[model samples]
Every structure is written in structure tokens, then in C-alpha cells.
Target: MGRKSWFWGILLCGLIIGSAASGKASDFRGNRWGGSMKQVAQQERAELEFRDDQSLFYRTRVAGLNCYLIYQFDRNQLYQAGYIIPPRNRNLNGCFQDYQKLLRYLVADYGEPQENQALWSDNALRDQPEKYGMAVSLGHLARQAIWYTPGTVIRLRLWGENRQINLGAGFFRRTQEETHPHSKTVFFGI
Candidate 1:
């Protein structure tokens, strides 16, 4: 190929790849925002359980982790979705491993999170035997990692206790409204 033709070909390929990657930001396992509960159920081939007027639940596996999903709707339009690790796999060490794996998968798909933090206070309760036992049993409550896209906010949280571990991810709509001022505003005479 001529030099000019090769340059144009490379540019076109780059654009196509960029667009495909960008399109994934708003999708959850091929289900995009505004998709209906019926659509998701059909896609997953799972039985959908209705929790209330605004929520639906189902079980599925994502990235090899068995999880239960809760889909929340506003006016019948899906506005939020959550993937939760099942209670059966709640060992503290196992939970941490699974959480790390999930985090890596999310980073690969969505790029780095906008805010990432991990917090633990093992020494805070060491002096108090009563609190220390509970604290240890409950493991540590890790800070969530959040990511923002144009119209969506994605959050990842992993936490557990001796008996139950919980790892979850939530995708929510990014509200467009501005926050109102704390104090009321007064208008001058026109």
C-alpha cells in the first residue's frame, strides 16, 4: 500500500476501535441503560423475581462470580442495577480475593476509577477486647471505588463478616439537576 493509503487506513481503524470501547461504558453485560426488566431476563435466560413495583431480582454469573442482580426502574425505565455476591461464599479471605479479581475486571473494562480508597482500623479497637472481637469478626469495611461516565455513576463495595461476605457493584444514573443552595435566595425588586 502507498504511504498515504496506509496512514488513512490506520486512522480509520483507530476510530472504529475507540468508538467500540466508548460504547461499553453505558452497558451492563450487553444490557444498555433504559433496557427493560423483561429484556434483561430474556438475555440472561434467568427467572426474574419481582420485589416491588420498582425493582426486579435475578441470579446470574458475571466474570465467573455467581451473583444476584437487582434492577431498579423509574417509570418502567431501568435507572439502576446492582450485582451482589451470594452469601454462601462469605469467608473473609475468599471475599477479599474475589473482590480483587472483580476490581481488576472492572478496571480493564471501564478504565481506572475516579475515586479509589481502602480503609481498615484494626488497631482502633485493639485496646478494647469487647469491640476487638466484633471488629475482627466483621472484617473491615472497605471504602468504595466510584467511576463517573457522562450519564452514569458506577460504584464497587466489598465488605464481610465472619458469617457473611458481601461484594457488590451498583450502576446509577448521574442526575443532571444542580444542588440547591443551603440558604434561601431572595430576589430584588425589578
Candidate 2:
């Protein structure tokens, strides 16, 4: 081939490879974000904890807490994965400690969150930081942290309702709707 043809050949090949790599759905573990549900089932590190029409939960441990690993699917294609520290027979103090431990783990792996919130609905216990957990259990406070990655958004939430504590992390994809003028996607900021 002529010198000009040789350079064009290499450039075309490079463009083809780059486009294929960028076509991947999203960044996550177990399998590609658009992979089959069976692909994730094969990689489970623990027993199945729960399941429904569109989600799977596996019992696992993270950050020293017994938790449930979550796998969510759309039309049987894996789209999201996360963890939830399950409910247990523990006090408010213990519950909040678990949240803190899990929070630190995410920060270590993904850096500081873009937004961190500890919202209070009542101030009766506001001055008592030591009893913040109690405030949470009483439905007076809720906490959440958010971090954004190249193609994913990570959220860590700790809240209470009906005197019950809840904690979990969710990984969701940020779609091209971010730039597509006609897309239906909406990103509600923290």
C-alpha cells in the first residue's frame, strides 16, 4: 500500500476499536450493565436473600456489616448493583454506627461525595449530636451522600420511618439524556 493508504488504514482500525469499547452500556461489576440476569446469578458470592419481578438480593457482608447485595434488572438485563445493611435487633446507636462504617467504605473507594445531607424535620434533638441516631430512629433526621462517576451515579442513604432504620447504596446509570435535547431523562440534584 502507498504511505497515505497505510496511515488511513491504521486510523480507520483505531476508530473502529474505540467505537466498540464506547458502546458498552455502563461501568459495574459481575457483568456488563446490559448483560443477562443469568450472568450475575453465576457470580453470586452468597446465597440469595430475596427476589421480585425485577430485582435480586443476596446475603453478603460489607464494611463489617451483614448486608444484602442487590442486583436489579430491566427486561432481564442487569442494570444496577448495590448493598443494603439489613435490619436487625439492635439499638439506634448500633444502627448509626453501621451507617458510618458503610459510608466510610464508599468514600474510600469513590472519594468524597458531591453532596452530603443530614436533614432534620424537627429540632428538639438538634443540639444533641451524640443522640443523632436516636433522632434518626425517631423519624426526625435522614442522611444521604451522592457521588458521580463517568457513567454511574452512586448514592448512600440512611433514614428512618415508623421507628425503623434503613440503610443502602444504589448505583444508577447516567444516560445520554444528559445531552440529548429530546430525551425524557431528568436528573434531580441532591
Candidate 3:
């Protein structure tokens, strides 16, 4: 019965390997990485706002903020997804508070971030937390955080431009980032 035992052992090995591979390509927001546009479109259940050669866009509300949800696909397979929130209000304090609230949600989902910091281009306002948002608007500061998950790399970015606070969250296939070096964004608008 040595041959029978060997066969069963090989079968068990195959099953284990398959499950592990699938785990490495887990789902993001219920949409599996490598899923097709047709598949995502049906599940999206929202009127498509725009479509380019390689991505799909939809408008939605998240965290009480109006946002544009983007899905980036390569070869018709999903590789990235995110939400872009437009500037809500021009108040400085309101901007920073919004950033903190979004950070808490991300931390709750992905645990502590791998990197969380306010990167400064100019330290003029570093000592003034009250002016942090204004500093960001003036191109003096930016807050960034990154989290690595089993099969995804999650990123949260908060910055200001032209006196408007901007917040965005991106979920990318871990493998995709490794494959594409020097990619600031999966797509131009991302």
C-alpha cells in the first residue's frame, strides 16, 4: 500500500498549494483580483460614469463624502481599485479633521499602517498643527500612509492643492506593484 499512500500525499499537497495560491490573490470589496469587466459591471449595479481603454469608473458615496470609485484592469482583469473624494470644504480645521477620520477607518480595517507620517516639503509650519492643513494647501506638507495586506497593498493619501483638501484610498494587487516599477499610479488619473 506504499503507492496508495504516495498518491494520497500528492493529492493533499496539490489541494494545499491551490488554496494558498488563491489566498495570495484575495478579494477587494467583494471583487476578486483578475475579475473581468463584465463581471465587475454586473456586480457594480450602478450606471457607469466613464470608461477608458483599461478602467471603469463609477460615482458613489463613502464616509458621507461623495466619491468616484475607480477600477483599473489589465488585460480585462482587475488589478487596482480606489475611491477619490472631492474637496468638501475650504476650512482648514475641517480639512484636518476629515483626514483623521479617514485614517481611523483605514487603521481599523488594515491595522496599523506600515508607514504613517506627515512628509514636509518645507518645515516652516511644522510646529503649528493648527496650520498643518494650510501648509498642505501651500505645498508645504503631505500626509501619507501605506499598509501591506496578504494580497493587496493599501495606500491612503491626504494632501491639499489650490486651497482644497484632497483624500484618496487605493488598493492594489501586491504582485502588480512588484511587476511594474516606477508606477506612481496604476493609471494617469489615479
**Top of the candidates by lDDT:** 3
lDDT values, one for every candidate: 0.54, 0.63, 0.65
User: Cα RMSD (Å) per model?
Assistant: 17.5, 16.1, 15.4
Candidate scoring better on TM-score of 1 and 2: 2
Name the runs in model 3 displaced over 4 angstroms.
1-26, 185-190
Looking at model 1, report the run of 10 residues with the lowest lDDT sum.
181-190
Q: What's the C-alpha lDDT at position 128 in model 2? A: 95
- The number of clashing residue pairs in model 3 is 0
Residue 189, candidate 2: alpha-carbon lDDT: 13
Per-residue alpha-carbon lDDT of model 1 for 3-83, expressed as tens digits?
A: 334323322321100001124534566666677767766665555644466566766777678876666555666655667
Tens digits of lDDT, candidate 3, 48-128: 777766777777876666776777676897777777666665677676666677778778766898988888988999999
Residues 1-190 of candidate 2 have per-residue lDDT tens digits of: 6533432232232110000012234355445666677777786667885566666667778888887676666678665566666568986778767878988997987789888888899999999988888898887988888777766667777777668677777665555224323223211111
Give TM per candidate.
0.64, 0.73, 0.78
Q: Any residue pairs clashing in model 3, and if so which?
A: none
